[model samples]
Target: MTDSKDLDQVRSEIDTLDQQLQELINRRAGLAQEVADIKMAEAQQARADGAESAEVVFYRPEREAQVLARIMERNQGPLPAKNVAAIFREIMSACLALERPMQVAYLGPEGTFTQAAAIKHFGHAVLDVSQDTIAGVFNQVESGQCNYGVVPVENSTEGMVNHTLDNFMDSGLQICGEVELRIHHHLLAAAHTSAADIVKIYTHQQTLAQCRDWLEAHWPQVEKIAVSSNAMGARLAASEPGAAAIGGDMAATQYELQRLAENIEDNPDNTTRFLIIGSEEVLPSGNDKTSIIVASRNRPGALFALLEPFRQAGVSLTRLDTRPSRTEKWAYVFFIEFEGHLRDPNVAAIVAQLEEQSILLKPLGSYPKAVI
Candidate 1:
């Protein structure tokens, strides 16, 4: 049995540790502010030396990823590594805000998973701007309205998001980072509504498909309506007495709806991967992934030829998907993701070989893999 005196002593020690931690964190924030000041001074000096506008970039995705990785690697604690990394992530985010506040754009009418991904990657210190469409999110970052944007790339169950892929074909924005989020969908209803009152269900088309098996097993007779977004469905359910919405926790909390059924997705391991977009190119982190769009000439074994270079270079290909080419009929462009920084000699050599074989080879920026 533990004595009350020992417990009190432990609590007192914890309080002392907390005070020290707070002081160290503030000191870290001060150092970050100094880093910003140095960068600004350098930029000003460059402009004075006859360079066209030397804009200082406060955020470095690669640097932050490295820091998070180190934190996770060094952690030896009662708390989980991921939990510790998350605590450090918020600390870094707050310190970065002190250096220069960041605005991030995400697809939303509010309460979307994309919005959650943006917050997960950039931390809540960032000002989140909601856009109706994925393209709108990209445009926000491209037009300098937001420093960065978060958009869904693919789902484990639903495959690629074609709209996001198509936008990348023309956009000059670089991929700065990636985020993978485990999706747990819920069936939600207003406080006054009940399962017996749910005559109709509303959800985004993709989400509806994800929850199709569960819906068919339980609520087969209920009318399922697919809306533009899950957040939109939550809106309709809030207004209609006989309606319920299928969405994530964010949507339920945002709309003040109660969960009727939780973890209702057809697949238990359903996850979505989101890409962070920005104008600045990221330097190589130790662990990185490169994304590219390549249009191979229409010929025998063109697909094999396009991928052979990666195999030959001993580099692992992470993902490959095809999109219809806009310039030519029956021709498709390949979106290739692979494990390596483009700066690596072997990766650069592979790119050179691909350029020769491909009619169009666009090296979408290499970015650090998701940290948390």
Candidate 2:
């Protein structure tokens, strides 16, 4: 205790330990990002198979609650809860920023999950505009109302968002960027109480659909009510003691409600992917993905001809979605998302061929692939 040099040595060792810890944490984060990138690629491939149809229009509030709770449970070390959330929040922000200062539109009434995802991708600093419906969001981007729009494309537990797909077919919008948000649902009751006394469950129609099987098994007799959106449902429940709503945790915290049940989905691997819409191209950063829409004549060989070029050009197609063309009764357009960028010579060549073969071909632009 009386030796100054000894104290100095101890401090120096502590400093070196701190340095090591920082390096170790950074390495771990880098690896996590890499894995996330791989998952995106796998999902794009999955979407191509029409298996994305499984979640075409589904939602599960309880399972989403579980994931966030687990994320909170696993958190440890010197980082505080807010700080850790902030880091991940920013990690997503940077991924969307590989192309910079993007303007994003979303379906919103404030506090909606789409709004949350929009911020997660573009950050609070981004220019955000919200419309009432998914189609409205696309229309805004299509009419140049916004630089890009953020919309839900698919959910792991539920299925594809047909409204979003339908809009993609009709509008000039194209998916320039993609982000996946692992949904965590919670039962937010207005007052602090147990689950037994709850009389009803409230949430968006989609949320109710996602958790349908789980809810039927547990609260079979409980009245399931649909609201405008999950966030709005939570807001209403936060003021009614016997009422409960399923929504993101932010809604619970905002309304000062109690979280009753967490992660209540039938599927544990539930996640939702979002698309970034823009009229022009995204400047690439080495890694990239491109999405396009091809409108074919409503004939027997139409779709086959549209896809043949990609197979011949050796272009790996990641997703192929067909939506009814609002233009006519039997008209339809094929939406395709694929690996590689427009800047790539091979990608450009394939586009040229597809254009010659199809009635209309729209390139949604290429954006940097998520570094994760």
Candidate 3:
């Protein structure tokens, strides 16, 4: 669009701009290294696979999402969401480098949703291990073999994962954190398949529950196979024609299986909540929750003493469950979840009162509630 003189002048300006950009990028990298060093102490001791720990901790997606959301709310930028997210991803990667690595355990044989959730929360920064059971996951963290453990607490379709609840009562693990994963299911097959030809479906018992109505109506005559894990079912389905597996999209892709159907879950809004447990206590967010197991002496006023403090503190009690106590007849452990942290003055005062009066008191850790 211009002459020789103009072209030369433009080239000179372009070179200047390139130099500035290079300097800015170099400065950013230096800052990242400096920040990563600070986080190294914590992340370094973490048990997650070394490479995963580096990436996940280094790039904290959740915190970045929160910050970028706030920035957009304020709207003082030329950056788009993706660009901003990317920038912060780099920044968080630096931040993670500042702390020691975190190790997280899960119930698994691999490619399980719990593993996915652990990765989601910890960012690929953790050492992910699949134990034989939920109790094992809890015990691993409790014994300090791992930094944290992830276990399913509840699912919208499956009610509660009772195995985890039972472990909660039996173990000394703290609920350090929580996360919800939006579940998506795929109909996977090893052989070529079509919806009309699929007669049998293989999946986990929980997955079966999620798709009960659909399965009953769609393939009433076919046998429903319950497998140990969705990935295992998917692997089975891949080897057999006329059979299909209900699992996440990743499993389907992992085996190079074609998806006969997607979004097969009956409820479009289904989600699962997972717990992160650690051996030690957690620092509470300003807005926090506390869970405790209260066992009172069989006397009349014992239960009342525990309830009175909560009422006085203006705490909202969300849940209370009575479980058979291991020790005595007619005695039960009343597991309670309430709004407020152990560190809150009012909550601490109530806990102190409960300690003196209750036969057994277990503080299950104060943590931020899952938002989504």
Candidate 4:
């Protein structure tokens, strides 16, 4: 219904709008740099005033969360709110990099889901360090080698990532944010390999489980071998003859493999939840969640006693999981996630009450819930 002349005029207007957008983005970046400078001055003043441990923090999780939320709230567009927020996420990421580039560590060989999650949470401007293990990711963040770490906590299909949960028990790192990534697995082979020639299939154990039904239905006779990671599987598939890998699009692209079958997971809505760990505690974002670990005395109804206060305070419990307390045989530690920031009056009162009921009540962190 549109004419060529009108289209040409609209295209010209769009180009002008893009130029204005670029100018505004650069101006925002300049303001972020100024904010960094002011923070540096405050740090210096604190040190001069005998506050020796003061350090300037350029990234404010709560502030960024608030900004993203406001952006979504103000969105009036043909584009969806999430799409608008994602655009602002990159803009904020670039602005933050102008001040100080964030270093993020994740469990990876480069193309793993954790890497994707890290990018999703921190945006593309961050410096991503690929650690061989989830514990390594935690160690890097704890040692201050990276500003943040991303680790998988649970998969919708596979439940908990025990290694990550166990590491949290030992580490003091705070949960700064969370990201949920929808997973789509593909059956991939090297470009030269054909479907009939594929005898061996490689993938991570979880990936193998996810695609179990699909593999049985199609490549029933194929030898299924579990590898360390999906990235490694794709790597092997790329190098070996008559080999295929079960992994996501990222790995297939990164390893230059050809997709034979896409979205082969048994579950259509497969998803994984990853947590962003950091050394600093996040202040209250308007909407936030708090995570904690509680070890109660070995007694019947101990958990009920521990949780009763939350119910009494009208606090909503989001998740609760129990793990064996390594220090004591047969004793258990409960990991709890609840809505509301720890600083909230109801949350604070509930935490006080929980401490009295449990042998150990460790407040992991209060952070903004996932914004995008």
What tens-digit string does per-residue lDDT give for candidate 1 at 253-290? Answer: 99999999999999999999999999988999899999
Q: How many clashes in each structure?
A: 0, 21, 28, 0
Look at candidate 2 and tell me the lDDT of residue 124: 77
Off by over 4 Å in 1: 1-5
Local accuracy of candidate 2 as per-residue lDDT tens digits, 1-372: 564568779899999999997787667656656655666666667788776332211111122223333555678967765456556555434443432345678877666788878776566756778688988887888787677788888887677788887676557655666777778777778776568878888899878877877788878898889987887888778766678888876677767777788887666777888887766545555556788878877678887888787788887887787877767787887778777878888888888988887788877667654321
Candidate 3 residue-wise lDDT, 1-372, digit = tens = 544568778899999999997788667767767766766755665535455544224443234445545554554567665455445544444345445555679977577788878766666645688887887898888888887899988888877777777788778778877778988887777656777777788899999989888878777888889988887887788888888888986677766788777888999999998887876666665556788888998887777777998898788997776778889987888888899889888889989999998888889888766532
RMSD of candidate 2 to the truth, in angstroms, is 12.6
Q: Whole-model lDDT for model 4 versus the true structure?
A: 0.92
Q: Tens digit of lDDT per residue, candidate 4, span 253-357?
A: 899989899999999999999999999989999999999999999988888999899889888898899999989999999999999998999999998888887
Which candidate number would show the highest TM-score if scored against the true structure?
1
Best by lDDT: 1
In model 4, what lDDT does residue 204 have?
98
Error of 2 at 171 (Å): 3.7
- Name the runs in model 4 displaced over 4 angstroms: 1-5
Candidate 4 vs. true structure, TM-score: 0.97
On TM-score, the stronger of 2 and 3 is 3
Worst 10 residues of 3 by lDDT: 53-62
